[model samples]
Target: MAEVEIVVAHRERATLRVGEVFLKVDADRARADAEVEAMALAPVPTPRVLWRAPPVLALAALPGTALDSTASPAAWAAAGAAARALHDAPPPPWPGPSPEEIAARLDRECAWFAADDVLPADLLTRNRRLADTALRPWTPVFTHGDLQASHVFADGDAITGVLDWSEAAPGDALSDLATLTLGREERLADVLAGYDADVDTGLIHAWWSLRCLLVVRWLVEHGFDPRPEIAVLEARR
Candidate 1:
């Protein structure tokens, strides 16, 4: 058989054109893709899952660039609206990992830190405190666990599609907003305004700070230099 032609290569996955089929593959990508396809709802154009083989899933090729590279404010608004629409979609009866399971995973990651690093400790504590206070009263909404621009695609002022549903879960919507914002505060403001979101900006900022700290600590533990960008973001706090 002739080898498939590679179209795009992303971090741990690749998009390939295999004869008449477009294949998107990475371990565990199928589960999320399957879930998204099975859930009946609005007109969101999630990739059509053709086949599943554990870590490898094949999806129809979506045509567009990742929203991260798109500069149009209208495109950003469309992305925000798409996220809101996905959140409003009724979820399937799939059993997601529980809070205890997530905490255990975090605990495993936290174990990588040594006494010299205080950021992880502070992050864990802050997450707990926020869970009790701010997040407690908020209604849980379906969240794109890793709602970053890299996972979205846009065409001019319209969102062409969204990708990477692996981290899809039920959580506070503001967390997703914070993740999307990351280092783009102005864009974040624009997105919030465009979406007419009622989330507390202060809390989102707090979470953004904590999330950055978590990244810094992870880099430190992995023997990477936590300099420059991390230092700058930390200085802003």
Candidate 2:
């Protein structure tokens, strides 16, 4: 029998790896459903669903390492191209949040962080100011809303698969690009080369600040380290 390896575990969800399959347990079935639907709709490669039982979704393990380290520039570019392909695909009909909604979220998170004292006021203030540009109107795209480096898996210079679709939705295209290159600014050129489109790098930076600021509270409350996100926020200064 294969030893069960815990991929991630928290109150709301957990994932375990056993042999070649990964079992995801989500307290919220809607998120799981969304993930499945998004994967099915996505133009890029996604993990194969082996089976499903309410609250437990079994997926075949993808065969590549996370894109955080030892990934060639070609692989990084491939990931970007994959993102572009997904964006080009028809977006889900369901509406995503508007700029007003996003601004409200930023205000709420910023206020909470300010009062909590978990983050320095200056850091919050600066990033909050930087987040302004990202609030502008954007043509929605089918976005992997949480497209971080770790969520992308690459085999050499080719992208094998992208993991975690729970947050997929129609949103700002730059948000996806920003998330992919977050904390890895050095790789921006390669990714953009693959993206092959005119993008406002400033807006990408703004999203970087916005996302990090918004996610800090959730990460802290969930008992996960928020340092990486905070680092990104600080960089905005």
Candidate 3:
């Protein structure tokens, strides 16, 4: 029998690994379509599409370990290089959520947190101070909308491949930088050096706070603890 592993399983989607092939079952077909298209457009290496059907995408796995906060600075630099390549590539046909939309969502989420007493009002208010920095306008590039550390794959100092492109679209490049470097400030310099662009540290920090704040409620609802992200936000103050 082939080795089968459940990579992820949740209400929105599930990914199963059978031997070297990965089967991603998504609740939304549009997301699946975006993944397929993004993979084709990405300048960096990505999982090969074995096939695709509505709600499921089959891909050949690439060899590497998942990128994480604990990885060495060299690895983070490599990830940055890969990201630079992705951003340098032409934008996808579809655009990501606009700043206005994201800001509105943030407003709603903050309200929800306050209304539900999810956290001390002061903490939320403190983080919201830098929130506007993140919502500022920026040039849109090809971005991996959900560029989590876990989504990047690396071998030693080289980036082997990136996974999970369902949210890939034309969006802010700093958002990706902020996502990868979240809670790992030590790697920020190396990553920025490899990115080969002028990046605003303040905005990156702002995005970091904004990203964590926006996801906390969703993470809680998904049965995942938001403590780690919360800690990062708290540390910013």
Candidate 4:
């Protein structure tokens, strides 16, 4: 019998790994459906969809280890390359969250952080100033929306797969790039090299701060550590 390992679990969703298969159970069927659809439409390599029935979606595990902070520059560049392909493809069908919606979220979270003393109001304030740069309008592209390093897999210089398409949507291309090189801003050059595009480094920095600020609260609420995000914010200082 394949031992079931809980990859991640929370109130909204849970992922379980049983040997070679990953079972994602999402409370929101629409997100799961969107994930399936996004994977199908993506030009780059995504996990093989074994089966899908409502909340339960089974996927075949990709080869190689998940990309991490310690991954080499070449691996990071490969991730950037994969992201470039995805971003260059036709945008997904969903409208996703509006810019106004994201801005509201950031404002609401900042207010909460100030009143509640969640992480550090001062840190949040400084980062918020920088974060504003990313809130501007940009040409929409096929964005992964949550291209965390952990969601990408690579074997040496080649990326074997990219995972978690639940947040796939039509959005800013730099947002994906920013998420890819989150805390490791030093690797932005390597990623841009593989991306083979001229990206504004300052704007990417803004997205980094913004993304960290927005997610820190959610991560704490979801029983996950926000230190990595906080560290990114701290790096800015």
| lDDT, candidate 1, at 150 | 71
Cα lDDT tens digits, model 4, 18-75, are 9999999998988888999999999999999998877899999999998876778998
lDDT of 1 at 178: 76
Top of the candidates by lDDT:
2
lDDT of 1 by residue, 1-237 (tens): 757898656555566777656666665555646445443333466666777665666666566777663468877777778777766766534544454554465454445433455444655455434433323344455666677787677767777666666666666667777777777777886678656767788777765654554465656655557674354344442
List TM-score per model, in order: 0.70, 0.96, 0.96, 0.96
User: Which window of 10 residues has the lowest lDDT sum in candidate 2?
Assistant: 117-126
Better of 2 and 4 by lDDT: 2
Stretches of candidate 3 exceeding 4 Å from the true structure: none
Candidate 4 lands at a TM-score of 0.96
Identify the runs in model 1 with alpha carbons over 4 angstroms from their true place: 1-43, 95-137, 213-236
For all candidates in order, the CA lDDT equals: 0.61, 0.90, 0.88, 0.89
Question: How many collisions per candidate?
Answer: 1, 0, 0, 0
lDDT of 3 at 200: 82
Off by over 4 Å in 2: none
Q: Per-residue lDDT tens digits of candidate 2, residues 1-237?
A: 899999988888999999999999998988899899999999998999999998999999998889975799999999999999999999876667788998999889988988888667877778888998789988889999999999899988999899999888889999999999999999999999999999899999999998887888888888899999888887776
Task: Put down candidate 3 lDDT per residue, 1-237, tens digits, no spaces.
Answer: 898899988799999999999999998988888889899889999999998887888999988888876677888888899999999989999878999999999999899888998768888888887877889888899999888888898888889899999889999999999998887788889889889788889999999889988999999888888998888888876
